[model samples]
Structure formats: structure tokens, C-alpha cells
Target: MYQYDEYDRALVFERVAQFRDQVERFQAGELSEEEFLPLRLQNGLYMQKHAYMLRVAIPYGTLGARQMRTLARIARDYDRGYGHFTTRQNIQFNWIELEQVPDILQHLAEVDMHAIQTSGNCVRNITTEAFAGVAADELIDPRPLAEILRQWSTINPEFLFLPRKFKIAICSAREDRAAIMMHDIGLYLYRDGYGQMCLRVMVGGGLGRTPILGQMIRQGLPWQHLLSYVEAILRVYNRHGRRDNKYKARIKILVKALGIEAFAREVEQEWQHIKDGPAQLTEDEFRRVAEGFEPPAYQGQGDDELEYGSHLTMDRAFARWASRNVHPHKVPGYASAILSTKPGPSAPPGDLTAEQMEAVADWSEQFGFGEIRIAHEQNLILPDVRKRDLHALWRLACEQDLGNANIGLLTDIIACPGGDFCALANAKSIPITHAIQQRFEDLDFIHDLGELSLNISGCINACGHHHIGNIGILGVDKNGSEWYQVTLGGSQGKNSALGKVIGPSFSAEEIPRVIEQIVATYCAYRELDEPFVQTVQRVGLEPFKERVYARAPEVEPCAI
Candidate 1:
């Protein structure tokens, strides 16, 4: 984790004081509601249906144990006893009081964290893979570059007020765990033939009213020009992106309207002027940032495999948990273990109680380094756990209700804090999520179903990333009632694809059965050991659609 320098601390504290004054003014009738709206948004505060929600940025999803402890303290003392981890690798406190926001911001600043750029039209938190430096198959860690982008974009006068919120994600692994395809700007970092770091830039990816996978605009871009090149892309967007309609303001919309070729040309034309400017990253600058992410010192001597294998053979329960929750580590005799926040209906997906948060922090130090990571899937990861300590960690994790052995299974559903919290939500997402979790509670059945992704969003904003799930569910408003539209065959990764809608939206009551029917159809046609996504791809959505709609006459199949 990167420690904050004097400048970083000063900026955060200054912002905190500034926002505190603004909040006080608004409460005292010195500022109108409309006047306070942008001020609050710029500071990552949202007036939700019930209360204010504060979103705190966890840059690249990395956290120190001390920082985690502070977050736990805030959850325990301030709002509710828990916080919701979002798909963008951030956390939201849903029951925040308007007056206490300044205090919360102060606490975050003390921990070298803040809510800056977590909301609003400015560039948001920069994200990369959770297992960035430690992934066994990683080419290079993308965090150093991601951090560079974060610092440059934070409070940059040129981009503070873009047409719409901009999201940027970087991925360096063979697998695209960061869901780079769905971001406003996605960069893939890799080494070229001469072993020089290079980037492949993609643009126009977003999911809201319109979902489109990013198109690769530039490849073989030198790492030295990373900032300069990105500046060029954002410049093009800042100038040409639509401002008349919020619905059509995303960079994706502009890219679509102007076409990729023309957009690339625009970026290139802008880049020529700044390509060799001071913005170009130098080796010393790269090392200065990279030093923050150096790998933890390893004590194991690569001899724990036999003992770990023996434990796996001895305990079937532990074996099951290990199979699903454990990830390969680049270091020998070590592994990254995912603590599933999506345990069941008792806790909503992506939510962690304050007690659980503290426990995770303690476990991170006990089992590995005192570093924690938040996955885009909304799970906490102990990224350097020793393989030898697998059994012990499993026992402790299971006791804490964080040991659900369903990483990529059907029940590991990704969902937004829908109508329950968010005012923008069309329907209640948690209830639907709980219903589906209850319907498919059997671990054996879910494991047999194989790797599957099911994501739900309260609305088309796609906050839960419904567009990239293998099974996507979007809540829609029909007159005054809430209905859910389903999409199948969507997937994220190197072969990312936007899911296609199966048919018309279904009532809340019918969602569980609808999902069950889709799974049933998948099981019937699936080949030996075929994953649900591969099955959907091979057979298409027709069978699942036919199965879902065939028996229903009461449910009308029409556009919402």
C-alpha cells in the first residue's frame, strides 16, 4: 500500500475543511439545495432515498490492515454496522448523516484515504486486477501505472467537469479480471518484443442505456507516453463529447457517433503536440511509484505443497473451500484466498459488517502480510496467505461467515444496493438477490452447475455490471410496478461480450423461477463439464428463452 506524502495529506485535509464549510452552509440555508448538489457530489456524498451515502475510494482496491481497522471503526460508530463494497472497487456507507460527513472524511484522510473522485463527472478511482503483482500469470503489475493515472487525474482542472463520469481500468494479466472492456477507457499493459513496456488502449466501453464493449484504438503505445497518450484521449472526449443530454454524454456515445477510426484520429492529432512533453513518464518516476507495490517478503521455501496437498486430501470441506476461494500466487508456497462477502441471504452480496471487516484485517496480518485487497467481484482477498496455513485460515474464515465456497458459482451473485438504498433504483435488488440465493442454497448443486456469473442492477445504470454477467438481470419500471429483464450469454474477461436479453421482463416473484428455468435449460444441453457461459455460447439463448416463456401465459412478453 502507498503511504500518503505531505502533499497528499494536505490536499485531503484541505478538501475536508472545504466540504465541512459547504455542508454547514447548506444546513444553515446559506446555500440552496440545487447549489449544494454539485458541492456534495464532488465530495462523494449522495442524498439517497433514506439518507446520505458516502462512497470512499479504495485506489486499486488495496488496503493496509490499519486502514481497514479505521473503516471498521467508522462503520461501527457512525452509520450502520456495515458498508457495501461496490463493483468499481469502492465502498459505500448507505446511512450517513449529512453533518457527520466531514468527520468521516477526516477519518479517511487520517488513514491516507478519501472519497475524492469516487463520484461526480470527474475521473473516478483508477482500478486494476486485485491480484495485480501476485497473479501467477501476470505479465507486469499495473498498479504503479494505475497510481500514476490516479494522481494525475485527481483534481485536474481540465477534466473536473466532463460530460459524464469517466471510469478507467488497467489489466496486465492474461485474464481480464478488472472488466476493462466495460470501462470508459481501458488499458492493457504488456511487454513488447524488445521487452519494453507497452499499452493497448481501448475506448468507448460503457453500460447504461447503451452497453458497448470498448474498441481497441491504439496498440504498441510506449509506457513512457502512458500519461501523454491518456491525456490526448481525454482531451478528445472533453472537447467532442455531447453536453446537451446526460443520457448521451458518455465517451462511449461520442465514440459511437464519431466512429472508432475518427475518434482515434482525433486522439492522435491531439497526442502529436504532447507526446514528448513533460507528461511523458520517466524511469525514475516509474520506480518512485513502483516502490510502493513491492512484493511482501516470503518466509516459505516452496516446500509446503506436500503438506498442503495432504491437508486437502484429509478435509473434504476445506478442499471444497480451497478449490473455489483460493487463487494462484506468483510466489511459491503462497496463495491468495478470497473471503466471499456473498455468503447467503443472511448478508447481502458485497456487504461486510464492521466486525467482519476487523476480522479480515486481523487475518491478513496473521496469515500473510498486513495487506488486503478488494476484488471487483466485491470480495475481500488476503493476497499473500501461505499455502501451509490454508486449513487454519479456512476454519477461521468459515466461523466468520466469510467462507462461502462459491467464488464463480451461480450463487456468488453481484448486485447493487438497489431500491433499498439508492434513490435512482427502479426496484429492490437485495430482496431479489436473497430470493435467488435461497432458491439455490445447495452448495453441491451450485458447484455442479460450474462457473457462472449472475449480476443484478436496480436500474440500467449497470452499477452491478449486469451487462457483463453470464446471466444479467436488470430491474425496470412497468407503470408503477417493478419488473426484471433478463439477459443471457454475457461474460467478462479476454472474451468479454454484452449479454442479450432473453425476452420481456418478469415480475419480482417470478425471478427466482425464471433463473432456475434458465439454469435447468443449461443443465439439459450442457456437455460434460461445460461451464454455464460456454454452454450458453454454444447453444445460444433460444432454448433458455423458450423454456422460460413456454409455460407462462400470465406474464406478458413485451418490452418494458
Candidate 2:
């Protein structure tokens, strides 16, 4: 994790002080609600349904033990007992008091964390693969460049506010775990024949009312040009992006209107002016930023296989958890372990209590390095756990209700805090998440169903990233009543694709059964050991559509 230097510390503390004054002025009637809106948003504060929500950026989803402890303290002291992890690799506190925000920011600054650029119509948090530096199949570690981009974008007056919120993601792994395809600017880092780091840049990807996968604009771009190229794209977007309507303000909308070729031309033209300018990354700066991500000292016990194998053979429960939660690491004796936040119907997706956060922080230090990572899937990752410590860690995780043994299964849902907390939500997403989680409580059943993703969003804004879930559930309002809309065959990764709506929307009460029917349909038609997504792809929507709509009530179909 990157330690904050004096400059970083000063900037964060100054923002905290400025926001504290702004909050006081708004409360004292010196600033109007409209006047305070942008100021509050710039600081990662939002007015939710019942209270203020503070979104704190976990840049590239990396956190040190100290930073995790600070977040836990905030959850314990400032707001509710828990916080929600988001798809953007950020965390949100829903029950924040307006006045206490500065104190919370102060606490974050003490530990080299902040909420800056986590919200509002500007470049948001720079995210990357959770296991960036340690993934076995990684071509390059993206965190260094991700950190560079984060530093360059933070408080850059040139792009303090864009027409709409922009997100950027970088991935260097063979698998697209960070959902780079769904970001405003997605960079795939790879090495060329001579082992020179390069980037493949994609632009105009976003999910909301209008969901569009990013289109690749530049390939084989030397890594040194990353900042300049990104700036070029942002410059084009800032100059021509729609501002008259919020819905049409996303880069995706602009890209769609101008076409990919024209957008690429514009970006290329802009790049011509800044390609070799001051924004180009230098080797010295790269080394300086990468120092923060130096590999931790390892025990180097590559021969832990015998002990690990014995444990796996002895305990079926531990084996199951390991099979699901543990991921491959570049180191011979190490692995990355995912601590699931979605532990059945007990908690909303991506939520962790203050105690849970503290326990995870402790476990990160105990089982691996004193570092934690937040996955875009709303899970915490211990990125360098030794293979020998698998059983002990599993036992501790089980005690905390974090060892669910369903990493890519139906029960491991990704959902947003919909109408329950957000003013923009059309219906409550938590209940729907609970309904599906409870329906598939049987671990064997969920595992048997295989790698399936179910994502829910309260509305079309896609805070939950429903557009890319294998089975996407979106909340909708019909005739002043809340209903749920379902989409099938959506997927992320190398072949990212947006889901297609199956048919008419169903009432909230009908969602669980609807999901059950969809699962049953998949089970019935699936080939031997075929995953839910492959089955959906092979059998298409007609089969699932027939089964779902057959049982669906004869209410007039609602348009999404």
C-alpha cells in the first residue's frame, strides 16, 4: 500500500478543513442547499434517502492494516456499525451525519486514505485487479501505473468536473476481474516482444440507463504515454460531451453519437499535442511510485504442498472453502484468499460490520502481509496468504461468517443498497438479495449450480453493475409500484457482454420464485457440467423466457 507523503497529507487535510467550513456554512444558512451540493459531492458526500452517505476511495482496491483499522473505526464511531463496499472498489457509509464528515475525513487522512474523487462528475477512483501484483497469470503489475494515474488525476484542475462522472480501470491479468470493459477508460497492460510494458486503451464504456461496452481506441501504446493518452480522451470528452442532459453526459453517450472511429480520431488528434509532453510517465517517477508496491518478504517455503494436501484431505469443509475462496498466486507457496462479504441472507451484499473489518485487518496481518485488497465484486482479499496457512485462515473466516465456500456461485450476489438507503433507487434491493440468497441457502445446491453471477441495482444507474452479471436484476417502478426486471446471459471478463431483458417485469414478491424458475430452467437444459452462462448462451433466452414467463402473472408487461 502507498504511504502518503507530506504533500499528499497536506492536500487531504486541506480538503478536510475546507469541507468542514463548507458544512458549517451550509448548516448556518450561509450557503444554500444548491450551493453546497457540488462542494459536498466533490468531497464524496451524498444526500441519501434518510441521511448523508460518504464514499471513501480504496485506490486500486489496496489497503494497509492501518488504513483498514481507520475505516473500521469510522464505521464503529461515525455512522452505522457497518459499511457497504461498492463495485467501483470503494466503500460507502450510509448513516453519516453532515457535521461529522470532517472528523471522518481527518481519521482517513491520518491513515493515508480519503474520499476525494470517489464521487461527482469527475474522474473517480483508479481501480485495478484486486490481486494486481501477485496474480499468477499477470503480464505486468498494474498498481504502479494505476497509482501514477491516481496521483495525476487527483485534484487536477483541468478536469475537476466533467460533464458526468468518469471511471477508469487497469488490468494486467489474463482474466478481467476488474471489469475493465465496463469503465469509462479501460487499460490492459501487457509487455511487448522486447519486454516493454504497453497499454491497450478502451474508451466509452459505462453502465446505467444506457449500457455500452468500451471500444478499443489505441493498442500497443507504450506505458509511458498512459497519462497523456488518458488526458487526451478526457480532453475530447470534456470539450464535446453533452452537458444539456445528465442522461446523455456519459462518455459512452458521446462515443455512441460520434461513432468509435471519429472518437478515436479525436483522441488521436488530442494525443498528438500532449503525447511527449510533461504528462508522459518517466522511468524515475515510475520507480518512485512502484516503491510503494514492493513485494513483501516471503517465508519461501515452497514445500508446503504436503501439509496443505494433508489438511485438504482431512477436512472437507476447509477444502471446499479453499477451492472457492482461494486464488492462485505468483509465488510458489502463496495464494490470494477472498473473504466473502455476501454470507447468505444475514447481510446485504458487500457489507461488513466494524468488527468484521477489524477481524479482516487482523487476519491480513496474521496470515499474509499486513495488506488487504477490495475486489470489485465487493469482497476483501488477502493477497499473499501462504498455502500452509489455508486451514487456519479458513477456520477463522468461518467463525466470522466470511467462509461461505461460494465465491462464484449464485449465493455470492453483487447488489447495491437500493431504495433502503439511496434516494435515487426505485425499489429496495436488499430484500431481493435476501430472497435469492435464502432460496439458495443449500451450499451443495449453490455449488452444483456452478459459476453464476447475479447482480441487482435499485435503478438503471447500475451501481450494482447488473448489466454484466450472468443474471441481472434491476429494480423498476410500474404504475407507482415497485417491480423487478430480470436479464439473462450477461457476463464479464475477456468476452464481456451486457445482458438482454427476458421479458416483462415481475412484482417484488415474484422475484425469488422467478429466479428459482430461471435456475431450474438452466439446470434442466444445461449440458454436462456446463456453467449457467454457457447454458444461457447455448440454449439462448427463449428457454429461460418460456419457463419464467409461463409462471409469471398475466399483469401487463412493464417496459424497462
Candidate 3:
């Protein structure tokens, strides 16, 4: 919700004009496809399998109702009549024309939005917890800091073409909803003994060809040095990070090669010079950025007349949704509602139609404040809905395809646009996702299963976040045929840990059965009400691996 100032406006406008010219030249045949590749990528345009995909950045996944309406308009006017919300809390239009992208950028700039840094090998959009400001358990609101980092990194001269794309996440709560441990840089905001805000910094976390959990670099860093510290880390990575091999170019690879102790030492050596410099935040600058994200005025209303318990007594479906989708807010009467984009038996995860977008915007305005949020799990959030309107909102949402009632369930999957759209994909991920959804259509069964994140990626790029899922599935190609490798015990929470592959890969056709076997093993081994993650950690992957590969002749019984 950070508003653009004059400098911000001017920079975006100039970039739009520059891209407009570049697009015009490409259309006029003045620029070859090879020549236009990087330019188009820098502008967030990708020539995908079907058409050009435009990824528009929703900074920290916060947007007002007006901005949501504009995005709906863009989906209607230009590309297809839908958009896909991604795992990074950004939105992508899958069928955009090459020539109309400049116009799309112009439309985004009109409302202080842009697709810049949404793609290419540079620092991408900074993500934070969706329930940042309103969450009941937060040390500090992280959006202001996320916004500050966004400005500093946008078109940064030195980092424009880093070895590979960099991702940063900030979390203020203990739950780690933003998947902080899976980012290139993760900052946890906390108050020290003196009640002053400080950041605990972690670096080198990523999920790609090589997945890693970030190592702690600095603890109890004063908030004033956030930007300068980040600058030092980036400078070190830029100067010495790998560039010869694309696969090992990420900061994670560098950190692994140098070892955590040496990397921490290097960052500390670099930070000693810049920690208290001009890039360090001042009180006025912090206040200026914080001004845009101050909580909206709310009336102090009691739950006397409200039917908080009555709704649960009246409707079972509504009760289930309230339990899963609704979250505790800082305010008494208000609650944050998460709208699941991974509706069962529909399109792949995060695919939302234009009408759905408009409907969400309207719902945000009607039931809550005129604001919305995008979660990192590819879901939407109405962060300020009242408790009284919960049932009505659920009913309306059910009418639209938006309501799936599968938050934190087995069917609520995280999958990438694999062979269907992505050029680097090894297999078709959507069909596999549909297959799993169909296999797990029983809601009661899924609810009883409890809090399992199943993530699938078509390849090792790990765009679907397979490395962080409780059950991770990665697609691989064997002689032009698709096979899947399954990993278990991964989690992206307070106790973050990477998943371990169960055993040998399975044929694509056998994946659903493999998942069912794993789930069955979990059900058998788990104690009363133990989640899949907990059960897996307690019993280890041995039991699940044995059960899953029991029937497969090709599977080898080795831990990943």
C-alpha cells in the first residue's frame, strides 16, 4: 500500500517510455528476437509456450480495491479473461500480445503498479506475510520495510544483472507465513530486551536446481541499518557470486561453496564499513514509509449481538471455512479471510478468471475495507472482513469459483504452469494436479488428514516450491517420457526443513498412487491429531518410503 512519490512516479514513467520504444522497434523489425530478449525480460514479458506472459508485481502482495479493479480491466481488455496468481504473490497474464504489453505497462503505471523486476536474473519482488499489519501476533509491521527495499532495489545499477534472480522475504511473526527460510534473504523483525525493533537476518536460502535453507548471518541488527546491510550482502554476492554456470550462479551456491562461517565473516567484514552510513534508515524516512501502511480506522464493536458461535452451530460448511480460512486480527471485531485460489477440480493452482478478480474486488469493498492481499501460497486475502459478515461472504464466494474451502488441505496444492505454459518444463503439471485433486475429492478425509502442503514442480527449477512442501513432487524426463520424484518431511514454517526424496522416481501415471500410499502411511503412523509433518519427522521417511515403494519394482530404498 506504499504510494509512489514524485521520484518513484518519474522513474516508472521513464521506464515505460523506454519499453514502449523498445517494443515499437521490435515490432518494426529494427530489433531481432535475440536482441529484444533481455529488454523484454527486464520489462517482465516472457515468450511462453502459447503466447507472451506478462508478470505484474503486486509489491508485498498488497493492493487497494481500485488497483484490483484495474487489474481486472487489464485482464478483460488485453490478454485472456483471466490471470494466474503466483507463489511469489505476483500475478501473471498467460496470453498477452507482444505489442499490447507496453500499453499494459502504461495501465499499471497509471495506478502506481508495474511489472518491473517480476522476471529476469535480478532481484525480484520482495514478499512479506499477507496478514502483516492486522495479524494479532506480530512484532512490527513489515510492509514499510519491504516497500523501502523495493524502492532501493528497483533498477539498482549494480544489481540489474546479477548472477541470477534474487528473492527476499520479511516476516514479523513467529509463524513464518511468508516462507522466510526459503528466500535468498530472510529478515525476521523482533523487539529486543529494550523493546526496540531489530532484525535477525538469514541469507542463501533458495529452492531451484539446488534447494537450501538460509543460514543466519546477523542477529539483533538495528532496523536503521536494514538497507545498508542488504547493500553489503548484494555487493559481496555481485562481486564474487558465480557467473560461469547458470545452475550455480545463485547466492545459495556461493554460500555453499564458501561455507556458512566464511560467508558470514565476509558479510560482516563488508557490513562494518556501511552499517551506519546514509543508506541506514532515519526516523523521518521510517515514518514516511510507515505512513502509507497505518491501519485503517475501526470501530470498537463487541461480539454481543454477533453470531460468532451461532454460525458454527447453524452451518457445518460455514463452520469449516471459518475454522480454516479465517484468521485472528489485531482488532476485536475484524478478521482476515483467506480466499483459496486452488479450488478443486478447476484450472491449475492460482488461475483466476477476470470475473473472479472483479468479484473479489467487490467483495473486499463490501465486506471489508477496500483492500486485498495475495498470499505466498497462491491464495487471495481480504485482510479486514468483519466477523458478522463471515457466513454471507462464504456463501457469495461459494457461488463464484473462488470458494474451495481447501485452505491447508491436501487438495489445496501448489503447482507451477509446467509444460502447459513454461518453456523449461519437463512435464504437464496441470493434469497431474487435477489427477491428485480428483483422487482426494473427499473433504472429510482431507480435513481429517490435517495441514499437509503438497507442492509439484515440472522440473528442478522448483517454481512450485516442491522443496518446502510437506510432500514434494518433482517431474523429470526419462527418454522423453515424464517421471516423478517424491520427497517428504519438508516444511516452511517456524521449524523450517527441506524435504527428503523417498526413493527412486515413479512413472507419471503412478504418481497419484504414490501420494496415496504416503498419505496412508502417515495416517497409520501418526499419533492422535498429529499433522503429516510431525508424523513424518517422528517416524522418519523410512516407513513412508517402504510403503510407497513396496509395490514398485524399480524403486530403491535410500533416503534423499
Candidate 4:
């Protein structure tokens, strides 16, 4: 994890004091609601459905055990007893009082954390794969470059106010776990044939009202020019992007209107003058930042496969959990385990109570190094657990309700705090998630289904990344009634695709059965061990749609 220096601490504390004054004025009636809107948003405070919600940034999804403890403490003492982990690798606290937010920010600053750039139309948090440094297949760690981006973008005067919020994701591995294809700017860090690390720059990708995969604007860009190149792209968007309508203000909209070739031309023209400037990263600077993310002191314990395999043979339940939740580590005798937040038939997706948070922190220190990670899928990760301790860790995780083995299965849902907490939501997302979880509570069935991602969003903002889910569910409002629209065949990763709507929206009560019918149709027609998305792609949506809407009257297919 990157520790905050004196400058970082000063900037955060100063912002906290400024926001404290602004909040005091707003509460004292010196500032109107309209006047306080942008100010509050810049500080990551939102006036949600029932109360204020505060989003705190967890940069690159890395957290030290001490920071995790502070988060648990915050959840225990303030607002509610739990917080919602978001797709942006951040956390949101609902039911926060307006006046207490300053104190909260102060508390966060003490731990080298803040709410800065978590919201509003500024470059938001720079995210990447949670398993960056330790992934077995990574070409190079992207965290050092991500940290550089974080430093350069924070309060940069040139882009303090863009037409819309900008999101950037970097992926070091070929697997694309960071969902780089669906970001405003996506960078793939890889070593070229020359053994030089270079970036594959992507532009115009985003999900929301208009979902589009980013086009590769530049390839084999030298590592040192990362900042200058990013600046050039942002400059083009800032100059040419629309401001008349919020929906048309994103860079994706601009890229579509002008076409990628023209967009690249513009960026190239701008880069001509800035490419060799001071903004171009230096080798020394790279080494300085890279030092922060250097591999931890790993012991040469050799392989623990013998002991681990014995435990797997002894316990079928543990084996099942390990199969789904564990990932391969780069080091021998170590593994990265994902602790599923989306347990079946109960607790809301992404909601972790204070006690659960503490338990995770304790477990991270006990089983691995004192470090933890948050995946974009809304799960916790212990990145360096020894293979020998896998059984002990599994046993404790089961006790904490973090032992669900459905990592890529149907029950491991990605959802946002919809109408239940967000004013922008059309319908409540938690109940819908609960309904689907209850319907597919069987682990054997989920595991057999294989590699299914079901994401639900309350509205079209795509906070849940529904557009990329294998089975996407978007909550809709029709004539003041709550309904859910379904989309099938959406996928994230190397072969990413946006899900297409199967048909018209269905009532809340009909969703669980509709999902069941879709699954049943899949089970009936699928080839041996064919995945859900592959089946949908191979057979087309007609069979699943017919089964899902078999009893309904004729209705036009919806698009989202």
C-alpha cells in the first residue's frame, strides 16, 4: 500500500477544514442548498434518498489492517452499523448526518485516507485489479503507475471541473479483471517484444446511459510518457466535449461523434508539444514510486501442496470453497482468497457490518501479511495467504459469514445501493438481489452452472456494471411502478460484450421465476459444461426470452 507523505496529509487535512467550514455555513443558513450542492459533491457527500451518503476512496482497493480497523470503527460509531462497498473500489456510508461528515473526513485523514475525488465531475478514483502485484499472470504491477496517476490528477487545476466524471482503469494482466474496456481511459501495461514495458491506451469506453467499449487509441506507448499522454487525451476531451447536456458530456459521447481516428488525431496533435515536457515521467521518479509497491518480504517456504492437498481431500466443503474463491498466487506455497460479501439468501450485496469488517482485518493479519484488498466485484481479498493455513482460514471465514464459495457464480452478485439509499435509483436493488439469491441458493447448482456474473443496478447509471454482467438486471420505473428489465449475454474480461435486453420489463414478483426459467432453459439446451453466456451467445436470446416471457403478452424488447 502507498503511504501518504507529509504533503498528502497536509492537502487532505486542509481540504477537511475547508469542507468543515462549508458544512457549517450550509447548516447555519449562510449557504443555500443549491449553493452547497457542488461543494458537498466535491467532498464526496451526497444527499441520498433518506440521508447523506459519504464515499471514501480506497485507492487501488488496497488497505492496511490498521485502515480496515478504522473503517470498522467508523461504521460502528457513526451512521449505520454497516457500509456499502461500491464497484469503483470505494465504500459509501448511508444515513450520515450533514454536520458529522467533517469529523468523519478528519478521522479518515488520520489513517491516510480521504473522500477526495470519490464523487462529482472530476477525475474519480484510479482503479486497477485488486490482485495487481501478486497475480500469477501479470506482466508487471500497475500500482506504481496508478499511484503516479493519483498524485498528478488530485486537484490538478487543468481538469478540476470536467463536463462529467472521468474514470480510468489499468490492467497489467491479459485477463482484464479490471474491466478496462468500460472505463473512460483504459491502459494495459505489458512488456513488448523489445522487453520494454509499454501501454496500450484505450479511449471512449464507459457504461451508463450509453454503454460503449473503448477503442485502442494508441499502442506500445512508452512507460515514461504515461502522464503526458493522458494529459493530451484529457485536453482534447475538455476542449471538444459537449456541455449543453449532461448525458452527452462524457468522453465516450465525444469519441463516438468524432470517431476514434479523428479523436486519436486530435490527441496526437496535442501530444506533439507536451510529450517531452517535464510531465514526461523520468526513470528516477519511476523508481521512487515503484519502491512503494515492491514485493513484501516473502519467505522461501517452498511448496505446501502436500499438506494443502490432504486438507482438500479430507473436506469436500473446504475444497468447494477453495475451488471458487481461491486464485493462483505468483509465489509458491501462497494463494489469494476472495471473501464473498454476497452470501446466499440473506445480507445485501456489498454491505459489510462493523464486526464483519473487523473480522476480515483480523483474518488478513492472522493468515497472511497485514494487508487486504477490495475487488471491483464487491468482495474482500487476502492476497498472500500461505497454502498451509488455507483450512484454518476457511474455518474462521465460515464463522464470519465470509465463506461463500460462489466467486464467479450466480450468487456472487454485484449491486449498488439503489433506491433503498440512493435518490437517483428508480427501484430498490437489495430486495431484488435477495430474491435472486434465494432462488439460486444451491452451491452445487451454481458451481455446475460455471462462470456466471449477475449484476443488478437500480437505474441506468450502471453503478452495478449491469451492462457487462453475464445476466444483467436493471431496475426500472414504469408509470410509478417498480419493474426490472433483463439483459443477457453481457460479459466482462478479454472477450467483453454488453448485454442485450431479452424483452420488456417484468414485475418485481416475476423476476425470481424469470431468472429460474432462464436458467432452466439454459440447462435444457446447453452443451456439455457450456457456460451460461456462451450458451446464450450460441443459441441466441430467443430461446431464453421465450422461456422467460412464455406466459406474458406480446411486448417490445427494451434496450439499456
lDDT of each candidate versus the true structure:
0.92, 0.90, 0.89, 0.91
Winner on lDDT (3 vs 4): 4
Writing each residue's lDDT as its tens digit, candidate 1 over 172-249 gives 999999989899999999999999999999999989899999999999999999999999999999999889999999
Question: Mind giving the per-residue lDDT tens digits that candidate 2 earns over 1-560?
Answer: 67778989899999999999998999999999999999999999999999999999999999988888888999999987999999888999999999899999999988888999888889999999898999999988999899899999999998988999999999999898888889999999998889899999999898999999999999999989999999999999999999999999999999999999999999999999999999988999999989998888988776688889999999998888888899999989899999999987889989999999999999999998899999989998999998999889989988998888989888889999999999999999999999888877788777777799999999989999999999999999998899999999999988998999999999989998889888888877788888888888898899888778785433321111
RMSD of 1: 3.1
lDDT of 3 at 127: 95
- Candidate 2, 137: how far from true, in Å? 0.8
TM-score of each: 0.98, 0.97, 0.97, 0.97
TM-score, model 1 to reference: 0.98
Cα deviation of 216, candidate 1, in Å: 0.5
Worst 10 residues of 2 by lDDT: 551-560
Off by over 4 Å in 2: 551-560
lDDT of 3 by residue, 354-410 (tens): 888889999999988789999988999999988888888899898887777889898
- Return the TM-score for candidate 4, rounded to 2 decimals: 0.97
lDDT of 1 at 552: 32
Candidate 4: give the clashing pairs: none
Q: Residue 91 error for model 3, in Å? A: 0.5
lDDT of model 2 at position 281: 86
Whole-model alpha-carbon lDDT for candidate 2:
0.90
Give the 10-residue window scoring lowest on summed lDDT in candidate 3: 551-560
For each of the candidates, the C-alpha root-mean-square deviation to the true structure, in angstroms, is: 3.1, 3.2, 3.0, 3.1
